[model samples]
Target: MSEYHIPVLLQPSVEALVTDPNGTYADFTFGGGGHSRAIIEKLDKGRLFAFDQDQDAAEQAAKINFEGFTFIKSNFRFAKRYLKVYGVTALDGILADLGVSSHQFDEAERGFSIRFDAPLDMRMDREQPVSAADIIANYDATALHKMLGRYGEVTNAKTLAEGIVSARARKPIQTIADLLAVLEKFAPRFREYKYYAQVFQALRIEVNDEMGALRDMLHQAAELLKPGGRLVVLSYHSLEDRLVKNFINKGKFEGEVEKDIYGNDIKPFKALNRQVIEPSEEEIKMNNRARSAKMRVAVKI
Candidate 1:
């Protein structure tokens, strides 16, 4: 799994992020070290810190023995606290490749992909006690329905939640196949794969508390970045993208951009791209995961 992920928008993201070769940088999600490797290559005397919560990712990070690179085996939500331990209070740039990695989905036993028959364990950090199975088995119908509709944007969230509640009462929904069987009727006949993806995404997001973690990281990133430092984020879903956009534009996750008494914007970062960046068709053809990636860059103001 060392040669696993092909970092989405690798060149463009790095080019936009790294303005000073001798400045500090962090890769918030160092999945297979794809983005970390690229960042390290551009650094001459700078230090690079890569964070990954997954134990499996530690093995891949071990392969990188660069002199100025440090790997942190924790979530990026704790970036500020952990980086202070490393004597890094501010950063020149911070890159967050959000959501699940390609390796996570490709690995059958990880239970991230619908293509596999495995336990419903989608914790990016496997050490976490709450797995997808736990959510399916324990979350109330209203909670499940809200998660599906809000995070996954599934059209039939109510029906799917009701179905899952009904089925789990008969037997525990322990595996992917079991959950699929319970929610199969709600899957659209023509877009079954899309429906399954949405349902699985909702469960995964809740189990990992991904949105909560993301918000924490964004707030920290604002404080960590130095003036003119770049904050490049590659989000795989609309929910993630919206959060990044709002935080960069308004300095908060919601509401319009606030201004000081002088009528100047009070945002910490300035949008680098007026429109969101996406992978080219050719790039998407090479890596299907790239199709959903939306990279947004901002400079800390």
Candidate 2:
């Protein structure tokens, strides 16, 4: 597990999640089974359901030998459907660590890291038909601009989009090196790495439909959790954190929360932490990836 992906906010997240040791729980992002292992250890007779779309993660899940653990090889968005198959309608708690795993980034062939010069394939599930390369090759300038600006928040999204269109017309951008050749011209001085990361992240999110999946999963989590059941999410980017925050506080993704006839906010979950929780300086020093993590805990109301 340690070699695969280090679990961020491990102790705090698990402690908050396992309020009832004998209750059913789910780990939506079973990257390396780190969180699932911890949750299983804390359980007495509790059943744990872990989900991950990645084949590599499925392989890791197979290594765990716990009677109470069930590994579901599917996207977390279909969590409710899969859990229902196991007769798990109501959950005690659900923990989702939302982001790409360390193993994915470290593996050069996965095309998740900026350091690698591999094929532009950043699908979480390699079985998926659309990839970063496909998006770059086919998307129009307007579509590309929206993706880069909205998902990546790239400053010069318009210019970059037009540039990509022009560059690809001459030759296709099929690999990491191919994209970088065009991207280098647009990147700011001494900030090439950051620019590359932003572009790659946008492509990854689109390829996986991450935001859409997250919205679906959150809605399912709200319906699946029992009263007072916990929903603990650790989001790495501002876009993910914002969505999690809105859903927990407002029930809906956009606009103000709706009120009932008696004027009570009709939200599903009550946030346990008023402010988003950040990793301690000590933890950040040990794991640099923890620096961007923002943990939010909520309880079904």
Pick by lDDT: which candidate is best? 2
- lDDT of each residue in 91-181, candidate 2, tens digit only: 9999999968999999999998879899999999999899899999999999999999999999999999999999999999998999999
The list of candidate 2 runs beyond 4 A from truth reads none
* Candidate 2, position 221, lDDT: 94
Q: State the C-alpha lDDT per candidate.
A: 0.91, 0.95
Error of 1 at 29 (Å): 0.4
Instruction: Tell me the tens digit of each residue's lDDT in model 1 across 1-301.
Output: 3348888999999999899999999999999988899999999999999999999888899989888999999999999989999999999999999958888989999999999999999999989899999899899889999999998999989888888899888999999999888767788889988888998888888888899999999999999999999999999998999999999999999989888999999989999999999999999898888989999999999
Q: Which lDDT value does model 2 have at 58?
A: 97
- lDDT at 157, model 1: 90
Clashes of each: 0, 0
Whose TM-score is greatest here? Answer: 2
Poorest stretch of ten by lDDT in candidate 1: 1-10
Provide the clash count, candidate 2.
0
What CA root-mean-square deviation does each model show from the true structure?
1.1, 0.7
